[model samples]
Target: MSQTLKQPRNSTERAGFRVDLQGLRALAVLLVMCYHIWFSKVSGGVDIFLMLSAFFLTSSTARRIARGQRPPLVDGWLHRFSRLIPQAAVVIIGVVIAAWIILPSTRWLELIDQSSASLFYWQNWYLSDHQVDYYAFNTASASPLQHFWSLSVQGQIFILWPLVLAGSALIWKKFFSRHNFAWVAGSAFGAIFIGSLAFSIYITATNQQVAYFHTGARLWEFALGSLLALALPWLSSLPEKIRRFGGWAGLLTVIGSGAVLDVQGQFPGFMALVPTVAAALVIAAPAPRSWTNPSGLLSLSPLVKLGDLSYGMYLWHWPLLVFYLEVSGKQKASFLAGTVLILVSIAASWCATKFIEKPAIAWQASASFSRLIPQSGFKLIAQFAAVAVGLGVASLPVMAWENNVEHRRAMAAAQTATDNPGANATEGWDPSPTSLVLPLATELDSEWQTPGEVCEGAAAPDDERIRFCEQGGTFDGGAPDLVLLGDSHMQHWSAAASAMIEEAGGSWILVYEPGCRYGSDADRVKETCSDFQDAAQDYVADLAPEMVLTTASKTVARPDAMLRSPGEQEILVDNYEAMIQPLLDAGSRVIAMRDTPRYSYSIPECVDSNKDNFANCDGSVGYALNSVNPVEKFLDSRDYGDQVVSLDMTGLLCPEGVCKAVIGNVLTYLDDSHLSKTFVLSAKNQFASSFKEATNWE
Candidate 1:
């Protein structure tokens, strides 16, 4: 995670070079590579790297401060990043080029975005925002740059840690004697460790997905290293026998933690102590007493060499493995294949370290360039600036290509009504064929529907279960109010529903949770889903709007079959009736929309890959949906007396018994199951007509 492969020789010389730590670095990267390639799981290795990086950094900076020198804030950043960035930029540019050649067009824009994020050291935050599951084993679909997350976290802390130490130094200078600097610094790091650890535990329990990539949550690992560095001198004074035992024990634990623990599921929290503390032990252990000692094994020459290439190897291995999986179409690499990957990664790492990282460092240290720049700090800054500029220049072609795709998507979306007739194509409206499809594969992120603005004041629901609320049209008291309630299936219908409602002199309020359906059976739902469903029912009852929109059934698609299960359909209908009873009592009409057909594959990705023969992506409506609407059965079984209605738009979605990926040049579904905004907007007229008939609206 950290560029700790080669610490500055000056620091190592002053500190009495810890050859064992170098070997530890080699072991850590090896664990990471093995686990990622063969096991598709996280090894505690990156956490160890993070700790080691902090240890080296804090030890060097504390020494400087103790000698009354400034913390070298700007120069350190310039020097560290200048060494790190060039290698990272090379890997990022290489991944971008490889992705463009090997990955599908649907993944291109995301690859570009993640590439920029990786280069700028914000890839962790980007992945967190997207809710990427780091533990998931879908290597072919995984981002080639995903491993850069740990590096990104390290980069951010590198910038922040120096400032933290500088502030502590200033506090010591102002409020205490110079001798108390260690105490002040220790206190600062301890506070960070305590506070970040507490936050990590809390967030991990609530949402481990976000906690994994959260910078604040991972800060404690660095702080632990900082604290250990401050105590290393005292620790080294321990008996050699104890140090030897600790070294062997720590090494064993570090190697075994990933195999024995659910590291991917529980990390950066209490569980992270295993590898991090073991790494601390390794760092604190004394040098080998003899060739057979625990420290002696780590100090071997081969490990030291591998450690020298560790940083570049960490950068190279993941992308190569991801590309390998993609190119080979395998879920995982065999042992031989994985070994080849490692060897190739090591070769690439050596080339990068020798050709790029060493040259940059050499140039920065060159006497001639130093003489020209004179001031060491300015020279460092200029070196870093050159690296940044080089990376930015390398990224320009990818950015330009992304912009062109965006421009084309905009043009395609704008022409949906004219060139892409969508549902109207089923109604005998023959539109001219167009080369592009609406909601281009690159634009799938924008396929989800949204209202004009977030709901507020009277329109907003008071309940916490209303995770997201948005309103369309003026909230003037005179406008007819309608509420759209359900999971993402119901949410995707909002574009056409909101447009139709606003055009009818009404306003729409949407209350939604992505995977939580409104009327699912309580026993069958997660606690969160059950709570949200109850809250949604209460909100709808209290508002008593003219109509409530909710999905009436759930459909799932598999390779062998695509249909709603009979048992699930019956339970859903029963739950729907119970849910609507409150709305009926409040004198509100209920319009239950039949769930859209689901597909086994991503519709847009299929369309993108099979542009020549679109039929390859098409599905049978008879298989994807019920022969008769499930909601009709619910209506016939109930005696609600015209209070409940069923709205089935399956005809428009899957015209003439076929659910085509592209309907009239407008892509229908964003992925397998959700309708695209562009396609829904194109079908607004038909949707509006269906809504009016169901509600008997004027």
Candidate 2:
């Protein structure tokens, strides 16, 4: 019970029943900040936020339904959109512009595509396709919009919740209710909350990262808050002492959960209940009659201020941290620098709320943007125009850049130079090692850094590659031909090799591992690798292909984790033998291409920073070769002769034993390993020659 939050009209009685609900808002924001900044122990803040969202939405909707009128669905949706869009749009546009200024072509286009997808609320699907693990270190992904997954989940909930609540209220009134909908709704809501929480716990224990990030598993926290709002009336009647005790208990629960819970293991399941229930208790607590209430602590000016800006603060902070780290090339700094970032983010948020959000919302509510008519009105036209223009803007860049000749050439050259060994030994290595290279402060792509297109018979899809292959058919023409089976890395060569196969009149069968490894024997790729291998084996058995083309062993597919050091070629050779034994037994020759070199630093990151000078990107091919495993030990021990030819990329990919990201005018690889779609298209000639030599394609 907070006395400071309760005001007495006269000396005789406490006039207001205020429990300082807004004060709890401050605590919620602090919990979030602490979790993001340093503490990973608790997820109390997200739960608190979820509870608040549910309570506020339910309370507002209940009031509307009680008035015998349906809730304004469009208005409610617009209100949410108005509140969120301004700051979000600003951040997105800011990221895009920043990316345009500093990022390399290989990175810029992909980030642009991702950002566009994210803005349209398609980020989750895109991430799933990219296999972007949400729980993985943030450094692994370069997208500023990755954090928006939570926002998307919240939006999804807002879309469905109001309608369900309204529909339920109407049903109850016509059937069981004696004109009382709140209690019925509350009871039904409680059931739903409990069920969802149970499901969350089950899913979290089974697969926590997906459960934690997914909306279905998290909706129960919000439902719990709505339930608390329904019970608040009964709680208000309790004695002051009891209310005070409840308040203290609630505060402790929130703080304690924040201090104890960790997001690393099982989370947002049963663990989330601690914070949700605590927040509910705080909201339900009665007002104090004297100066003894502890709620005042949260109501302090600074905390309240932070609470007010919490929404915008959440949106701006992560991107700022990302950009700062990108520019500085450093990890998070001391408290002072972080505090400054928070303050700056808060200030920026305030400005965004003032100039963009408030104005947009106010204007939208006015008669100008409002549609009195349901359809075929000026408002509808305006909405159509906005959508059309946004789509047009997004599509134009993709169209324009996809056809650029120089860009295409650069991309092709990069693919050939980075993935296949050619006559040019120094094709992709940076020449001037002693020259100083300044890190670019912005993320932009120039024409010189673009890639070609996806390989021809490759499963890789691009604007240019249009041919589709059925699972059982011959790719180019006949049996005793070539068959390429692998992941995206394998798909990268379709254009080049498929053309040669067509010319040679030999069939090229292609089967790509979607979320699977290429090798048949690697058990670590248990997800889909085994299935892919089974399919390939069946295909190879049916087709009786003369040669099977695949890449070096995947790092993940390695049997042991200690293979990171030099001179491990034998371990890799063992991995290859395991993948090839079945193919050999089936009377097919297996040719293994050496894996492409990864930049010494993160590829997309360097591309994001526009690091043209390759010092950071330079890595030793010998090290990459050594990464193969115990070389001599395996080679001497094995009898699989001329059948196993290493199509080493070092001839074109590295010079003087060093591999680099940039060569002459072209960016080497699109990402760390996969050749860019555009680059793959350009490399057709070189790749064709290699395939001919490896399998006698012509």
Estimate every model's Cα lDDT from 0 to 1.
0.82, 0.58
lDDT of 1 by residue, 261-331 (tens): 88989998999999999888877777753554567888888897788889988999999999999889798
How many collisions per candidate?
Answer: 0, 36
The window of 10 residues in a row where model 2 has the poorest summed lDDT is: 1-10
Clashes of 1: 0
TM-score of each: 0.87, 0.72
**Model 1: residue 32 alpha-carbon error in angstroms:** 1.1
RMSD of each: 4.1, 8.3
lDDT of 2 by residue, 438-464 (tens): 111112132112122333443333322
Alpha-carbon lDDT of model 1: 0.82
Using TM-score as the measure, the top candidate is: 1
